[model samples]
Target: MGASFFSFSFSMVSFSSLRSSLVPTRMMGVEGQWWRTSGNHWRAEGRDDRMRGENEEDSKLSLDFTSEEKMEIESIKTYKKDLLDDIQKLKMEIDSVMAEILSFESAEENKTIERNKQFSNGKKKFNMDPKKGINYLVEHKLLDKRAQSIAEFLYKEEGLNKTAIGEFLGEREELHLQTLKAFVELHEFSDLNLVQALRQFLWSFRLPGEAQKIDRMMEAFATRYCDCNAHVFQSTDTCYILSFAIIMLNTSLHNPNVKDKTTLERFISMNRGINNGEDLPEDLLSKLYESIRNEPFKIPEDDGNDLTHTFFNPDREGWLLKLGGRVKTWKRRWFILTDNCLYYFEFTTDKEPRGIIPLENLCVREVPHPRKPYCLELYNPNSQGQKIKACKTDTDGRVVEGKHQSYTICAASAEERDSWIEAIRASITKDPFYDLVSVRKKKVINQTPQD
Candidate 1:
C-alpha cells in the first residue's frame, strides 16, 4: 500500500493549548507521618500524640497471627505468583502470534495497487520522452506546484549528464517526501478537533492525566503493540475511529471495574459469535463508532493514584522532566513523592512504578544557575549499597565521582521546588511521635480552661 493510503491520522494538540489545559492542582489533606509496615502497606499512625495513645492497643492486638493463618497466607502468596507467571506466558504468546494474525486486503487497496502500477508505467514512458512528457504533465496539471521550480533549475542550469539528471530526480523524490510529511501534519492538525473534544470529555470527569495518557497509549499501540506495520481499514476516517475503539477496549480490559453496560466486555460478548479479523460484526462496529463520537466517557475513580493506602503517603504526584541515565537527555516522567521514597512512572496514566529512589540517609540540596533553574539535588550518603541506574560507577561497584550518588531533579517552578524540598526534608527528619507530644500539650492546655 502507498504511504498516503496506509497512514492514519493521530491527532495532537498545539503546545500552547496542551500547557494551558493541564494545570496541576495542589494536593489536599496531605500532611501526616504515615507508618510503613514490612508488607509495604501505609497506615495512618495518627496525626497527634493523643490520637496515637488512643489507637495503640488496637494496633498492637492486630499483630497477632496464628500458625494456620500464616500457612494459608503463604499458600495464597504462592498461588498469586503462579497466576502472574501464567499471565506473562499468555502475553508472550499474544506478542509472538500478532504478526501472523491474518487480515484481508480490501477492494479499495486492490484498486490503489492497480493505479500505482499504471502510474509507474507512465513514469517509465515519461523518462524515455522527457520533452513530450513534460509538456503533457504541464497541460494536464498533474505535477506539484513546488516541483516546477526544481524542474526549471535542472533543465535550465544543469545540462542532462545522466548523473546530474539522476541527482535532480533524487531531489524531486525528497521534495515529494517532504510534501507527504506536510499532508500528514495537516491531517493531524485537522484531527485535533476530535482530540480536543476527547480531552473535554476526560477533563469533564477531572481526568486530564488520563486524557494525556491516551496519547502515549495510542503511540505505543501504533508503534509497538501490533507487530504488523500495515493496518487494514476500509477508509481513513474508519481507521482512526476504530483505533480509538481499540484503545477504549484495551483500557476496559485492563480495568477490573469495567464490568457492565457500555463496557468493552459487552462489545466483545456481542461479537463472540463472529471471527475476529475476517468477519467483524457491522452492528458492533457501529456501536463502537457511536461510543467514540457521542457517548459520554465514564472514567473510573481508580484512574488516579491511590497512594493513601500505600506504605508511603504520597504528598505530591505530577509530571516532571527527568534527565536520562545513558543518553543524558531530558524526558517527561510522572513523579510521585512519598514520605520515604520517590517513584517515577513511564506515563502519568501508568499504574506501575518504573523506578524508586529511597530518601533514607540522603542529602537534599539546591542547584544554583543550572540549565534548569528550578532544580534540586539528592546526594546519597554512599553509592556502595544503593542501586541507582542513573549513577555512573567504577568496576569495583563504587560511584565514579566518589562514595555518594547525586541526582539532580527539576520541578516546574521555584515554588514547586521549595514545596518538594520541604516535604522531602520533613519526611527524612520527621519525628513520628513529635505530633503526639504537641497534641497532648494542647489537650492539657484546653483542659485547664481560663486560668
Candidate 2:
C-alpha cells in the first residue's frame, strides 16, 4: 500500500477576481491501498502500516493550507478598506483647496474694481470743487452774475454783508434784505446757522401735490448757481420765492423760547412783504406750517458742519426703508446722496456711514412690487441679463462683493419714491465733465452767427 499526497499554490490577484479563481487545481498524489472492512468504509490492510502513516501526514498538510488561505483573505479585506478611507480623505482636501481658490479670485476682482473707481474719481477731482467750478462758469459768462453772488453767500465769502444779499436779490433787494435781516435777528442766527437751517428746511418740508414745486425751484437754483443743471434758468421768480421761504422757515424754527415762538400768524406777517407786498397763499402757508410743526426741522448733530448744509448744494439726505440682502427684510436706514455716492447709516446721528454705493454706471427706476408699495430699484443696466444681487454692507464699510448688483428701496409714498428717483438721476449727471461740456457747447452756440 502507498500513501497519497497533495500540493497547493496561490498567486496575488485583485480582490474582485480572487473569488472566481479561488477553486483549487487537481494535483497528482501517491497511490494508497484500500480494503473494505464494512459497508462504505475504506481502510488500509494490516500489512500497509507505512501507508496509513503517510495518509495522516497528508491530512495535516491540507488542514494547514486551509487555515493560511483564510488568513490571507482577511488581510486582503483590511487592505481594501484602508484604501477606500484614504480616497475619501483626499477628496475632502481637494474640495477645501477649490474653496480657497474661489475666495482668492473674488478678492482680486474686488481690488481691480476699487482701483478703477479711484482712477475715475481722480480725473473728476477738480470738477468736484463746487466753489472753483462755479467761479469758472461765472467768469466764462455761462451763468448769470447773480449766480456768482449766490455762491458767495453760500460759501460765506469775506464781505458777505447785507449789501451782498441785496445785490443777489436784484431789484427787490430792499424788501428781501429787510425780511432776511429781521428773520436772522429774531433767531440770533449766524451765517453758518442760516445755512444749516436752510438744509433742514429743504430736507423736512413736504406738502401733498406740491412736491414738484420745490423740486422745480431747486432745479432752477442749481442750474443758475451750482452749475448742476445744463438748461437755461427757467424762472428767477421761483428762485426768489424759494430763498424767501427758506428765511421764513428758519425764523419759525430756531427761537429757543417756547413762549415767544413764531406762530403761523407771525410767519405770515413776516413774509407778507414778499412779491411786492402780496402775501403767500394762506392755504399753502397753513399746510407748510402744519407739516413743520408736526415734524420740526432739526439737522442731525453729525451733519452740522457739512458743506451740503449750504444752499448752493446738491444733496438729498433722509430716512428710507431699504431691503436686506441675505435676510430679505425691510430695514429703516438714514441715506445721504452726495458727490456721486449714496451712503447709508443705521441712524441719522451716526457719524460714520455703514456703507457707500457709487452712483456711477447705475440707474434708478420705479418698480411694481407684489407685497410692498412705492418701490424703487437701483441696478446696473449692463449685467448681461442676469438677475441682480441685493446690496449689502460688510464690516469694512464697503459694499460686499457678489452681494449687491441692485438695491430695492421703499418710500413713504409714491411722491417720495418719484422724488428719490429724480434726485438719484440728477446726481448721476451732475459731474464736472458734464459742466465743462455744457459751457463749451453754449459758447459754440453763442459764437455762431444769427440765421
Candidate 3:
C-alpha cells in the first residue's frame, strides 16, 4: 500500500511540472499575437508624427532663408542710396569752391583797378600845366623832340586844345577807352581810323569781370556804325540780339584764357536765352564763327598822320619763332615792334619783355634758313657787340647778361615776313621831324618864285 501511494504522488508531481511548462508556452503564443497587432499600429503612428515634424522644420528653414534674402536686397538698396547721396554732396561742394575762387579773383582785380585810378588822378592833379607836362614827358624820354614838335603843331596849327594834346601824350599812361573814344570823336576820325583805333584799344590784357564792359562797348559801337544798326532791323530788339551775338564772337576770339574757350554748341546755348528763348540757326552761327575765325578784325594801314604823332606805339605785334642763342632751339615768342625797339615776350600777356633789340643801328633782312621758311635776321652791321639788351634784372637792380649779337626769326608766311620787315624799317626811320622838314621844304619851294 505504501509503494502504490508513492507512485501516484510521483505521477501527480510529473503532471504538475508538465502542466506548468505547457501553460507558459500557451501564454507566450498569446502575447506574441497581441504584440504583432497593437505594436505595428503604435509604430506607424509614431513614424507619421516624425515625418510631419521634419516637414514643419524644413518649411520653417525655407521661410528663414527667404527672409534673409529680402533683408540682403534691402541692405544693398540702402547702400546704393547712400552712395548716390555722397556723390551729390561732393558735386555741390565742388561748385561752391569754384564760385568762391571766381569771386576772390574778381575782388582782387577791382582793387588793382581802383589803386591804378587813384595813382593816375594824383599825377594829373600834381601836373596841371600842359607845358610842364610836355617838358616832363620829354625829360623822361617818353616823347622825342619829333613828338614834341607834333604836339606843338597840333596845338598852334590844328587849333587843338590842351586836353586833346594831353590825351594824345598820356595815351601810354593808363588811358581809358572812353577817353580815347572821345578824343577820336573830337577829331572826327574816318571809319577806317575809327576801326583802327578800336582795334588798338582791344589789343590789351583782359581784366576779370570786364566782359560786361566789353559787351556794352561792342553794342554801342555796333548800334552806331555796324550794318546791324537799328535801321537794318525793323525791330530794335532784333538789332540788339544781332549785336550781342557779334560781341560774343569777339569775346571768344580775343579772350586768351584757354578755360574760357567755348564750343559751337555751348555758344549756341549761351545765345539761345537772348533770342527770346528760341534757338538760332545752326548754319548761320557756324558761318559767323567761320568767317570771324578766318578773317579777324585787323588794324588797317594808316595813310594819314594818325600813327605819326604817337610815340613808342606798337607797330606790329604777332607770334614769331625765335632761335634761342644758348639752347640752339626754336621757341615761339610774341614780338612787338614799338618805337625803335623790337621787344619779345614768352607770352602775349607777359608785362615784361624777355629781350629788347634796339632798331637804331640794327637792320633786318630776309635770310634763307636750312630748315625754315619765311626767315629773317636782325644784326648790327657796325659792331659784333651784343645787340639784344637784357631786360631781366637781378635783386640788386643789375641787368642780367644773356644777350646775343644777332636774332633769327621765322614768320608764318611770306606776307607776314614782308610786313614785319616793312614795319621795322618804317619804325627805324620814323621821325616827325622828317615830315616837318618835308613840309617846310615844300613851303619854301612854293614861296620861292618860279625861275
* Residue pairs in collision within model 1: 42-310, 42-311, 48-436, 49-436
lDDT of 3 by residue, 151-202 (tens): 3333333322333343343333333333334322333213432233344433
Tens digit per residue, CA lDDT, model 2, 199-263: 54343222111223333333333333322222222233323443445444544465332246668
Q: Which candidate is the best by TM-score?
A: 2
Of 2 and 3, which scores higher on TM-score? 2
lDDT of all predictions: 0.45, 0.50, 0.51
Question: Which runs of model 1 end up more than 4 angstroms from their true locations?
Answer: 1-314, 381-404, 432-451
What's model 2's TM-score?
0.31
| Pairs in clash, predicted candidate 2 | none
Per-model TM-score on C-alpha atoms: 0.25, 0.31, 0.30
RMSD of candidates 1 onward, in order: 47.1, 29.0, 30.3
Positional deviation of 97 in candidate 2, in angstroms? 99
Q: Which ten residues in a row are the worst by lDDT in model 2?
A: 1-10
Ranking by lDDT: 3, 2, 1
